[model samples]
Target: MSDKSAALFALTNSLQPVKRVWRQAATQIFANSGISMSLANLVVIVNRNAQGINQRDLAEEIGMNPGAMVRILDQGTEAEYLERRELSRDRRFKTICILPAGKKLADEIESSANKLRVQLMEDVSVEDIENATRVLRLLEARASNFLQEHIHEKK
Candidate 1:
C-alpha cells in the first residue's frame, strides 16, 4: 500500500479501540441515570446558554429537523428541565431555557464526564493531552471542510 493509505489504515485501526473504550465507560456511567445518552447531550446543550436560546437556533446548531427539535423540547418541558418563553420582539420564536433542576443535572453530568476524561488519560502526560487537543481541533477543521466540499447543498 502507498504511504498515505498505510497511514490512514493505521489511524482508522487506532480509533476503533479508543472509541470502544470511551463508549463503554460512558455507557456504564450513564446506565442508571434513567435518561438516554442523547437526552443527556441535549440537556448539556440547553444548559450551555446563559440567557437561553431559540428553538430554531438550537435545531440549526445541532442540525436536527424541526420536528425532532420540537419533540426533544416537549420532552424537556414535561420533565420540568426547560421552560419555553416567547420572545417579545417576535412572539413566534420561543426560547428554551434550562431550569434550576436541569442546571443541577448538567453539573452532575459534567462531573461524570470529567472523571471519565481523567480516567482515560491517567497514564498520558499533560503535555501530550495538550498536543492531542490541538491535533483534534485541526482534524475537526479538515473534516468540516471535507464534508462541506463533498455534500451537496439543499435546494
Candidate 2:
C-alpha cells in the first residue's frame, strides 16, 4: 500500500480495538448499574425525541429492525416506563413517548454517562479532544458518503 493508504488502513484498524474496549467497558458499567446497554441506548434516544417519534422513525434512528424495535418497546411497555400512543389521526401509527418512569431511568443513564465521560477524559487536553473528535467525525461522514454513493451502483 502507498504511505497514504497505509496510514488510513492503520487508523481504521486501530479503531476496531478502541470500539471493543469501549463496548466492554460500557457493558460492565451498565451491568454494575443494573441496566442493559440496549435498553439504555433505546430509552435515551426516545427521551431525546421529546416531541414524540413514531415506531418506524425510532427504529431507523437506533438502526434496529422494526420487528426488533417492537420487542424492545414491549419490554418498555411491560415495565410501564414507556408507552406507544396514537399521536396521529391515522389509527395505524403510534408514537413512542417516555413515561415518568422512563424519564427517570433516562436521567440516571445520562448521569452515569456523564460520570464515565469525566473519568475517561480526566487528563485529556481540550484541544486534543476537539481535534480527535473532528477527525473521527470527518472520517465517519466520508465513509458513509462513500458507501451511499457506491453501494447502489452495479459492480
Candidate 3:
C-alpha cells in the first residue's frame, strides 16, 4: 500500500478502540445517572439551549428523527426532567425547556464525562492531543466536503 493508504489504515484501526472506550464510559455514566445515553445527550442539548428551543430544532441539532425526539421528550416529561410549553401567541408551537432536575443530571453527566476524558488522555501529552485534534478536524472537514459533493452528484 502507498504511505497515505497505510497511514489511513492505521488511523482507522486506532479509532475503533477509542470509540469503544468512549461508548463504554458513556454507557456506565448514563446508567449510574438513571438515564439512557440518548436521553442524557438530549437533556444536555436542551439544558444548553434552555431559553427556548423548538422540538423540531432540537431534533435537527442532535441529528435525531422528529418521531424519536418526540418519544424522548415524552420520556423526559414523564421523568420531570423537561416540559413543553405552548407559545402564548401560537398555541400550535411548543418550546422545550429543561427542568432543574434535568440541569442537575446534565451537570452530573458532564462531570463524569470530563473525568473520563481526562482519564483517557492521561498518558498523552498536551501537545500531542492538540496536534491530534487539529489533524482530526482537517480530516473531518475534508470528509464532509467529499460527502457533500458525492451526494449532490448522485441527485
Candidate 4:
C-alpha cells in the first residue's frame, strides 16, 4: 500500500481507542453524578439557547425521535430539570426550557468533564494540543460539509 493509505489507516485505527476512552469516562461520570447522559446534554443545549425554544426544532437538532424527545421532556419536567409552556404563536406546540436546577447540574458536569480532559492530556504539550484541535476542527468541518452535500444531492 502507499504511504498515504498507510497513514489513513493508522489515523482511523487511532480514533477507536480515543472514542472508547471518552465514552467510558463520560459514562462513569454520569453514573456517579446521578444524571443521565441525554439529560445532561439536554441541559447544556437548553442552558445555551434558553427556554421557549421550539420542541420540534430542538428534537431535530439533536437527531432524536419526536416521541422519545417528548418522553424525555416529560421526565425532565417531573425531575424539575425543565419546564414546558405552550407557544403564544401556536398553542398546539409546546416549548421546553431547562430549569435553574438543571443549569446548575449541567455547569458542574461540564466543569468536571473539562478537568477530566485536562487530566487525560496531562502529558501532552500545549503545541500538541493546538495541532490536535486544528486537525479535529478541520475534520469536523469536512464531515459536516460532506453530510450537507449528501443531503442536498438526495433532494
Top candidate by lDDT: 3
- Give candidate 4 regions above 4 Å deviation: 13-17, 60-63
Assess candidate 4 and give its TM-score to the true structure. 0.78
Q: What digit string (tens of lDDT, one per residue) describes model 4 on residues 19-123? A: 878867876766876767777767767777764577888787777987898877876788897898888898999888878887887788778888888988899
- TM-score for every candidate vs. truth? 0.78, 0.84, 0.80, 0.78
lDDT value for model 1? 0.81
Alpha carbon deviation, residue 136, candidate 3 (Å): 2.2
Q: In order, what lDDT does every prediction score?
A: 0.81, 0.83, 0.86, 0.80
TM-score of 3: 0.80
Model 2: residues with Cα > 4 Å off, grouped in runs: 32-34, 151-155
Kindly state the number of residue pairs that clash in model 3: 0
Candidate 2 displacement at residue 78 in angstroms: 0.9
Per-candidate RMSD vs. true structure?
3.0, 2.3, 2.6, 2.6
State which candidate has the highest TM-score.
2
The residue-by-residue lDDT of candidate 1 on 29-125, one tens digit each, is: 7789787665666677789997998888888776688777787778778888888999999998899899998888878888898898898789999
Candidate 2 lDDT, 44-73, residue by residue in tens: 888988977898998888778999778778
Better candidate number, 2 or 4, judged by TM-score:
2
Error of 3 at 74 (Å): 1.1
